[model samples]
Target: MTVRSLYLAPVTAVFPAPARTGQGGAAVYEQQRNRTSDADDSAARADRVVELLGARDEVELALKASLGGLPRERDETLARMAEVLQATAQGLALDAAAVWADMPERVLRNWLAKDPAFAAALRSAEALAGAHGLAAGPATTPTPAMVRVAVLALSRGATWPQAVAVAGFPVRGFRRLSQTHPVLAALVEAARRARPRKPKNFVPAGYRPRRPGQAPPGPRAFRLVRREDQVLP
Candidate 1:
């Protein structure tokens, strides 16, 4: 116990710098990835999203101006810019949705319910809440108008909501009429018992012919699988 003790002093002399070796230059490897995210874009992007939706400007301007300096905007120049812009605007392009002109009324209706800005537009229009009566659902399964629309829509090839709108019934106040119309009750019973439609065969995507501008695809384009008047093979 009266022996010696080792000093805990630090080593001051540096070793040969270890030949400056450690998996080569990790700096270059780490820098390989692009670290830019949308958050890094100009501070005005939020304003741009709202502005584009309101100004009703072409999507190209929105993409170029709003997404300026972003890789997607640059890469999109070579492809179908409209399609690309549209996809980006679907969920995040809150205001741009107004420009989806071809979207059906029923689809727009549902979207308005889910989107606050769109819902605000409906509120301003004063027709958003009960416009389709779906929020309340139906205490009873279906009313006369609902049944009529349902059968017509289902039979004539419309979506459920499409039939609801096309038949022109107040979805909310429908119960009021349900008691007045017995046929509607019967129609629901019929619809509930009716057979469901079969799924149609799909046209393969890659099956193009050698010739360009060949007379456009016939009835298939119109979704007419086989008409009685169609010339047979």
Candidate 2:
């Protein structure tokens, strides 16, 4: 057989390709780029969420450590309350946490009052929430409704729950709002100090007022009356 040489054409010469320089090509490129950017953004957000959750977990651990040396039942109760507080800090409403925990909101409030550890945990959780931007912050300019509610809270001598109930507002929302808002918190504090005070010259009911410079009445002697039904002892 005679020697023969075979030549092969370049792949690009054999298969001509369309140019990708028109609006259609640009549109496809832009779409793909947007998709990649969106995916990256989603991943970053997921990582941030995980970091926040881990921080919350650390708060819980610290809370548990603080609750040490308590009675078993009390420790459990405080732990539960801490969990509720953390949930609230993470955007769950206080009333909703109460509902989820199958208890009345008053119980939670009372726990906060009676247990200092629980209260501390609540403060920590709230601070964490604020730091992490999880909790709502004070408004730049409060709305009319917010002002009205705040005024109502300030004007009442009743407890927060009672005042909020009378105002037809949810106690949890009002409490959270007041805590986050400086003006509202100040108003609430003023309301707390607004308890009725007695006048300087006030006298007890059923007691006669003494004349000026008159001596106060002395203590009376006690006398026992004999019972007719009792036999002589």
Report the number of the highest-TM-score candidate. Answer: 2
lDDT of 2 by residue, 209-233 (tens): 6799999653332212223442211
Candidate 1 lDDT score at position 224: 14
Report the Cα lDDT for residue 178, model 2: 74
Error of 2 at 218 (Å): 54
Model 1 regions more than 4 Å off: 1-150, 157-159, 200-233
In model 2, the worst 10-residue window by lDDT is 224-233
lDDT digits (tens) for residues 1-233 of candidate 1:
01112232222231122344466544433333222222222223432332333233355445555644433422332233333233222221222222233223454546556656545544433333245442223223333323433443433344545445444445544445545655444343333333244469676888756597677542221111212432211
Angstrom error at residue 109, model 2:
0.2
Model 1 residue 15 lDDT score = 16
Cα RMSD for candidates in order: 29.4, 27.6
Cα RMSD, model 2? 27.6
Superposition error at 229 for model 1 (Å): 17
